[model samples]
Target chain A: MPTRILKKSWFIKSIFFTSAFIILLIGGITYRNIDDLSKSSELLTQTYRLNVELEQIFSHLKDAETGQRGFLITNDPLYLEPYDAGRENINYSFAELKELSRNNPTLQKNLKDLNVLIDERMDYFQKAFRFSAVGNYNDQNFKENFYKGKKLMDTIRLKIKGMIKSQNDLLKKTQHTYESNLKVTPIFLYMVLLFSLVLMFFAYNKIIRDLKEIKASNEQLEIFKESANQSQIISQHGNWIWDIDTNTFKYSDNLYRLLGEEPQSFESTVENFMKFVHPEDAEKLSREIEKMITNKDLPFVYYRIIQKNGTIRHFKGYGKLHESSDGGKKLLGTITDITDEIDNLRILEDRNLELERNNRELSAFNYVASHDLQEPLRKIQTFLSRLEDKESSKLSEVGLTYIDRIKNASTRMRLLIDDLLQFSRTNRADNVFEVSDINELLESAKQDLAEIISEEDAIINSDKFPKINVIPFQIQQLFLNLISNSLKYKSKDRIPEIHITYSKIKASDDPEILKPKKPYYHKIIFTDNGIGFDNEYAEKIFVLFNRLHNKDEYSGTGIGLSICKKIIENHQGFIFANGKPLVGATFTVYLPIT
Target chain B: MQEDYINIILADDDEDDRLFFTDAFDELRITTNVKTFNDGVYLMDYLNNEESIFPNVLFLDLNMPRKSGLECLKEIKQTDKFKDMAIAIYSTSASEEDIEKTFVMGANIYIKKPNDFKTLKKVLSEVVTINWQYHTNGLNKDNFLLRL
Candidate 1:
């Protein structure tokens, strides 16, 4: 793209150079034409002057001849005066002709020959005049002399006419040459002017085109700068530049606004900007700025600033060195306001501390429930048993009944405590999950209820299970609780038949799994042929201490199913219960197949 | 001392528990000599004496005033004289933590104190009859707790 621009600029430059050269050429041609016209006109003027000198010489010779003829006809001495004056005038004209024809060889030679003919004509006139003074009117010598003078005068006039014709011919030749030059010069100069004008027009068009392009790009740059300023305000950031060579700073207009002042309200210098810095952070910020100047770079620096309205804000800054093509060094920097983030972090830290305290207190409560509360209760039961064994015979029937009632109450209390402890243990954070054999865990659970299984004649069928990742002890307890729940609510007429089935299924296959966190789950379904309740209580059954059956009807602490739910949730799995009155209950547990 | 009868010792802080232990032993038909201490300190003081007779089975109650059953077990297991003696951890609340700790410290078995007098007598007799050499050979975490 830049290369294309460079090529275009080169084209414009060549056009500019071509236009200037054409203009200079026009100026040189016009100057040379003017100089040639002036030289040609000067030659024409010299030729006109030379022709005038030649005509004057001929007129003077005619005057001298006319005077000599009058003297010969009337013997007037006044005529002699005219002849002498004419001779002097002719000599002066001859000198002027010689001076005018000095540079022209052909004209000088013609003038010299004309001078010789004039001199011969004058000699004949003198001879004729001398003969007339001696009164020899009838003498043949005088008559011959006069005739010869006339002939000599004719030759001189002819020579003068020849020189005049030749001089006129030379003048005509000079005029023709000057007229021809004048004729072609206007056309040539007009064509050269027109060509230069065309070159100038092209240069003007290119300049206008380039200026339009520059205007378009400049407008785009202006729009970009405006948007950048708006973005800086929105994002709570500002930009700056520090010229390292001159140690001068340039802050963008938005940078001034970031300091809680109008744009460009203050000079952009370190001292001027430092006035806004929080006193506590000023020293640190100064040290960082100093380092940035020396290193020609700025690492991330955090500081605080108090605005004019007394609102304190946290700022983080970073800079990078920019070296322009002309070898100017500058640091381009950006600073952001991060007060909101720091405040959020502080709130999160406080909340975390409170949560930790609450957790410690909860564990303390668990310890009390496990050890302290059970100690006294165990002693009471032991003493009660002693009473039943040793003093039963002495007591009345009512008193013995009271003893039995007390025993039942204590046993129920112990059951409640033990179940509650089991529930809380499931909530422990440190339970380790391992790859354990599900079959082994199931067998162990059944072994825990071995005597009941035999006495109730419960027929428990199971499917072979693969190794699964789970909390071994907790999963065993889950199996134990579920099986016991079935036995406790067994139908009286038919023996309890518990069917345990296992399969690996996709979470999408189960409609009950809403918003599943995992794709596949280990589905273990425990379907028991027991006295089931209405399906309406399926969800309520898992609630802590929630029971569908009364204590008199079923010996449940209502904590068993709740513990199952908790265990499933700990593994990010799901548990569901479905039941129909007297048909049976199906408890489905889904563990994530990790 | 009679060589044919078994020697048993129990250390518990509760007076009523001590009375129950003696009464159950008195009712049983097994020919045994029983000794009792109120707390671990008195029990340790008597066992540490060189002249005192060591019991074949030592039952240690976990909760006590000066020292606990776990601490006493640690001390007894470290002594060479008590290497062959069977140590049983007997506590009211048989928490998994206590059972695990006592097992690691070389206790032979763990028993939660039974709530009824008959169950207590039954557990004591069963424990007395157990062949320590055979039980120790097959001891594991699963059977470490003496289930009812």
Candidate 2:
């Protein structure tokens, strides 16, 4: 359908061309008509001149005839002189008329007839004049010549009149033709001029309308280009299209701007685009592009580019293999400047490393302080006890009391140091969590505290426990501390009874118990019938160095529960306690199964 | 043949540790002759001397100023002279790495230095009464590292 419309428009254009060609052809015809009209006018002038010369020749013959008649009657030479001059003039006019009439066949025939009649008349006149010039008296001959001359003169007059009448008709016909041709030439020229003017007006109007349409479209194109450029700059993302088969490249305006280059600075080609790429990245980028094409998969890549001003910038680009409308493979993608993001990531990684190093150093410091500090205190207690035992008899009561105080202080210091060391060592130990039976660990803890349990008369009971992945030593320590805690805080009036029960629970079943959303956990609850503190101090009991009773009332450094809490946390679990005044406390520990 | 009394050797850098150790042994009422050395260097010198009497049991202190207990243990285990002797690592540290290392090096026992003299006496008396042959025959990691 479009082709048909195009053909129709072509036809219309050809019509205009044909009209112009026709106008040119008509103008040529008008020019030819004007030339014909001029030639006709020139012919009419020549015919008129011939007729005038013919009349002159006829008059000269009449003059010669009259002179001859006079000379014959009076036999006078003066009359013969007039005849001679008429004869000479008639000959010259006749030759001129014949020369002018040569181009017209009809006039040439008439001139020939007139020339014959005038010659006969001229012969008769000459004969009469010759007799008069001789001075001879020939009356009879002269009388005969006179009658003959009169008859010949009558014939010559008739012939000359007929010839003159014919020449007058020819001249009138030529003049009419000349007048009509002169009148038609201007009308023909005007018609051709009017036709050309109309065709030219139509062509000029069409051109003006087309020019206006072109101007409007050009304005729209300029607006489109301006908006495209603005959006490219705003996004900091530029597009590129490369045709592999044709080796042609088209880069967006922002792409050139990003590379710090002017538009159209050079041809947009792969090699030219590569020139801006940093030398270090060029080979890799080229290889990636090749791989992308062969693999038929688009991959995102990050690379560095050296701009025209020699500033290095990081760019992230991705491209896909696109089959263009022409069935040729094309790479079309966008490049974004990612230098800021890369720098931010680098800084973040560095900070993370520094933090890890500081944490490790701090843990080491704790371990060293706790472990090394205990040595001196142990020695002091050992020596002080020895001194009191070996030299008590010689020392005064004050000295003995001072020695006992020092011994007590050193022992307390030693306990505190040992507890701190255990607390720090929990974090410093190599975290190797293995599948361990909690029941076995409990039994071992029981054995470790067998003497204390027997001395305190504490009853320890528990349900069957499950196996879990945990650091065995830490977990064992946890069990020992809790059991020992129960023994330490036992009621004076009754023997302590500890009931331990464990049940498996999901994170969803008890959301408040586990912060991390693990699938399963072993919720081991230790309910001890001991001298429990107020419920408000339940959380405080787990804090390091937070004791419910004074050092004299309870023998503990107050670090046991905190170590248990630390151990549970290391296994990604939770430990919490609930206590009521004069009632037993319930300590629950959650250990993830996996 | 069974000896009349057990011969025990202790190598430690601290003066107080040596005194506390010998005092604990004296009060323990054990039939044992206790020998003391200031550092692993002196202990190694005494052990390597051809005329010196080898002890029935050797207690090595780990963190010494010169010649660490680990170095001394390595040297003693390499020699055939100290083959019949029971080696024990007695240090202030109960670190797993130290225990495992000494255990692998064929040390019969590891003892964390006791804080109180009473506990120290009990640990020393228990260690002395143990039949060396039985302890060496049934040697395992569970019964190797002892903490008091």
Candidate 3:
């Protein structure tokens, strides 16, 4: 879309510049032609004036010679008066023509030749007049002198006339040029003026069209600005533009709202805007902006603003750069309200804290429920066992039978209670994990059940156990429970053989395993040659109260495997049971080694 | 379980508990001499008294009227005179905290009192036999750590 606008702009701009160039070129050519035509017309007019003056000078010289001949031969002053005036007019006209033609060396040289002929004619007229008056008054001498003077005057008149005629020919040609000019000037002027007017009209029309476009754009800009303001109000985000050259800032009211301020609440300088930013976030935001601006790139900053109401509102400021004529920078862009985003983050944090607290409570509850609930059950078993121990000696046959039954019932009840605890604690995060040496922790747990372990003739062996982060007490309890359970479920005909081994298991990268992923897990596999279950019940055995054999078959708490499952799960891992009915069970526990 | 100077102390926070315990002792016909105190504070005072009798067994209740059983045990265990006393932790609550804390504090045994009166009636029947001190009869002062 923007490319389309650029293409349109390029097309219009080229048209405008091309038309302007064409009009200017044509106007220049017409103007140059008009100047040359006007200069030539003025020169033609001057040449005509010079020709008329030369003709008058030639007539005056002839008149002055006639007056001198008449006065010297007939002695009349009347004819001399007209000649003297004519002579004066000739002298005045000659001086004026000479001064006018002084810069034209060609015209000056021709005029000088005519002037010498006139002077010779005048001297001849004076000599003829003196010879006719005193030396030879005879008709022959008179005729001779008169004729020589007339011949000299005729020669001077002819020379003057020749100059006048040549000037007249030039005048006729110049006048023709003048007439042609007179015809051409108006037509040329009108064509050029009309063409110029037409061009100007087109130019003006184009300018008007451009003005209209600009006006429409301005109107659209106004509407855009208005909508922008409205949008800022609705969304609490304002946009701004800072012209680098003008050093002016413009922004919508939403910008002020984000700052927890009013338009007039603070000074409208960049420094003033930065002042409202939280001090801690300000440095970070400014640093980002500085890095971007110094490199003449756009900058993005997110920070909090302390509003007038003492609430911290988050804002994300973005800046675009514009360089002034002198290469100074101006940051122009928008500041958006990110208070909701910040609030969401805070809520998430609070929820995580709540989850952690709930987890801790659950762990404590699990431990308490197991320890507390087991106490009564243990006491019941101890009493029942004691009663059974003395059944033969202290009780009648019926009483003996009843005591034995009660002992079995109590032992079964103990197993049920343990199963119930496992079932309840399974869904809870009730395990506290810590980095511990598995060997030492296991030894301590074994010490706790020393009497039973030693009496069972059980051989406990293991590889170098991993020192992993896990719940020490829970893991120890798990070992004791499983070992004791294996001993209790030992095949009546076969001696129980237990093997405790540790191996590395591959970790999963399931989407549910968020955050840092542990790529590997250390597993503790406990294989016992005892009364195992069908492979179909492998998963079921880990469930609460999932027992295959009845009370008569084997004495066992169905929750033993379940407890192991729970403990392993608490350590961010899993447990699975693999066994065959009446064979042995292999309980593999996977614990993440941190 | 013995008549030759086998002495035991029974400390309880409740008067009724002491009375009931004394009745049990009488019914058992235990030859061992018994001493009872209502609170750990008085028990501590008695132990510190010039004419105090050192007992082979000490049954200590956690919640007492004055000075808790744990504090009394701490005070007694710090000294060589009462350090060898076979202290059994008795409490109504069988909480993991109580059990762990007692064990961590070097308690010899942790006992939870039965809630039902029927169980309590049968519980005290063979109490003397499992009193722990009797089991370690051959353990002298120096070999006490190896007995339990």
* Model number with the top DockQ: 1
Best by TM-score: 1
What are the lDDT scores of the predictions, listed in order?
0.87, 0.81, 0.71
Off by over 4 Å in 2: A1-239, A252-267, A279-302, A308-311, A316-319, A333-338, A509-511, A514-516, B1-9, B22-37, B41-55, B79-84, B118-130
Question: lDDT winner among the candidates?
Answer: 1
- List clashing residue pairs in candidate 3: A363-A430
Q: Flag the better candidate by TM-score, 1 or 2.
A: 1
Order the numbered candidates by DockQ, best leading.
1, 2, 3
lDDT of 2 by residue, B1-148 (tens): 2377788899999888888888888887777889999898999999989988789888899999889999999999899978878888899988777888999999999999886677889898888777989888998998898754
Instruction: Return the clash pairs for model 1, or none.
Output: none
Writing each residue's lDDT as its tens digit, candidate 2 over A38-145 gives 776676677667657666766777777777777767877687776788889988987787787777787778777767767776676666656667755376775677
Q: For candidate 3, what is the interface RMSD?
A: 8.0
For the predicted complex of model 1, DockQ is 0.65
Tens digit of per-residue lDDT, candidate 3, span A1-594: 333444456545765676677667767766866775685666666676787788788778767866776776577777677568776887788797897676678678887887777667666666666775575766676677667777876776677667667666765776677667667766766776676667667767766766677778879888988897788888778777665556666765677777766755665656777788888888887777567546645566778878767788888878778676568767668888978877899999999999989887876687567656665665556556545554568778988778778767766775676566555554434456578888987788778778877777777777788688877877787887778877877877776788999877566643323332478778788899887878898788777667778868776667777777777767777677788777888887777767
Error of 3 at A22 (Å): 11
lDDT of 1 by residue, A1-594 (tens): 333455688777887788788778878877877787787677677767766767777777777777888888888877777688988987887787788777889988887788788888888887887887788878999888877877887787788778778877877787787788779878987887788787778878877887787778778888999999899989888999999889899998877877888988889999998898999999999999999888988999999988899988899999999998679999999999888889999999999999988887887688677667777788889899989888999999999999999998889888888888888778647889899999999999999999999999999999999999999999999999999999999999899999999999998988888888889999999999998889889899999999988798788999999999999898888999999889899999999999
Candidate 2's displacement at residue B79, Å, is 4.1
Select the stronger candidate by DockQ from 1 and 2: 1
